[model samples]
Target: MNKTILSLTGAVLFATGAVVAQTMAQSTSESTVAPQEADAASVARGAKAWTNHCSRCHNLRSPSELNAELWDVSVQHMRVRANLPGAVADDIKAFLMSSATSTGVQYSTPGQGGASVASFAHLSPGDPLHGKEIYSQTCIACHGADGKGTISGVPDLTAAKGRLTKTDEVVLTNIIKGYQSEGSLMAMPPMGGNPDLTEQDIADVLAYLRKEYDIAPGTE
Candidate 1:
């Protein structure tokens, strides 16, 4: 009798969670792709892409954040704002819809454990335009407005995207932690020498770099 009661209770909890997730999905503003277009392989690719690309700027957003339609709108906005290619945008949509509210199952975006770039809260809610302004004031002196940097000591912000190995979480430490250039005598002050810069300012700067430089999450 106890075992049966426990089983029933577990089922009840799972059912409740599913229902709440579904309701959130329905109410969300993200636009949804057609159900038929969603497939396992594409979803997997999207997960990988999300980890590499999206996670750079933000955490793995819960799938329930938006309904199908809202996901469509959100993805479309990112495509233009972040310059996602046609096929990739489609894959991400399919993945988000499929995972949004599956009954009796849970999903987290895959391949998040070994972040290639450092991560931080500053980059999580980065605003691209606002980031551009911050970058102009703080980062431009070293990284250059075009992101080419000083070539010898400073890293080229534009090119780092192609070779980025650190996760955003890990990369945040790089920004927040700061670094001394190896064998090059150039030293970057922790927090870019400005204690007043908020995490949002950092986030915005990272966002601007990703958008303006077209930094796709590297395979690394």
Candidate 2:
């Protein structure tokens, strides 16, 4: 009888081990497959949604033009502008925010160029809200939502060190006239090709960048 009991115990242990191993393998497979499936679905949905809802009124712009906060406002406002339902609009915003290369959070430091908001006098009193609108229409695709560029060679504004040193005048001038970096085939097209943006619109965007990026105010 004792031998019989021992044999039963051994069999139970073996069965338990097999079950655990099977579970582990299944778990591993799921972990790997789920993300890829979800990502694929998201991409398909984003592409379809963008084409149907976003392409008509606007062009595909860089995401870096505005930070996340600005993008949030811009997205909300654009819902109305695009005549999308609230739920659909929210989904589009989520997709864009998720898929776009911009950091969803605003940064507190200057980007690579060593420029900061302190240098700009005009940006001191600029309105981030208005700037958000301008950036959404113009800068969101390439620059991303966090002022970080998505393209490999494109400069990341959040990482710029030179931006910390720029004056408001310089920032304003760049926005108005556009810039062309060496070896860059694409210049920052004038107001990102939107001739409709007013000078005040540009100023508002500068202000938003200063405030979000934590640029110090210049002493008068």
Please list the Cα RMSD from the true structure of every candidate, rounded to 1 decimal place.
Answer: 18.9, 16.6
Candidate 2, residue 93: lDDT = 54
Model 2 misplaced stretches (Cα beyond 4 Å): 1-124, 217-220
- Which stretches of candidate 1 lie above 4 Å from their native place? 1-124, 160-165, 218-220
- At residue 87, candidate 2 shows an lDDT of 57
Task: Give the top-scoring candidate (TM-score).
Answer: 2
| lDDT of every predicted structure (CA atoms) | 0.58, 0.57
- The digit string of per-residue lDDT tens for model 1 on 1-220 reads 9999999999999999999989878655354443446564566455445445665565556455566678777877877776889678877776565544423121221135421334353335778899898777656645666778633456666665432344454444455545443354443434553445666677677777778977754442
Evaluate model 2: give its TM-score. Answer: 0.42
Q: Which digits, one per residue and each the tens of the lDDT, describe model 2 over residues 88-202? A: 6655554555434332222322233533322344334678998887666555555667877644445666754644246666556555555545555434544443445667788
What C-alpha lDDT does candidate 1 achieve relative to the native structure?
0.58
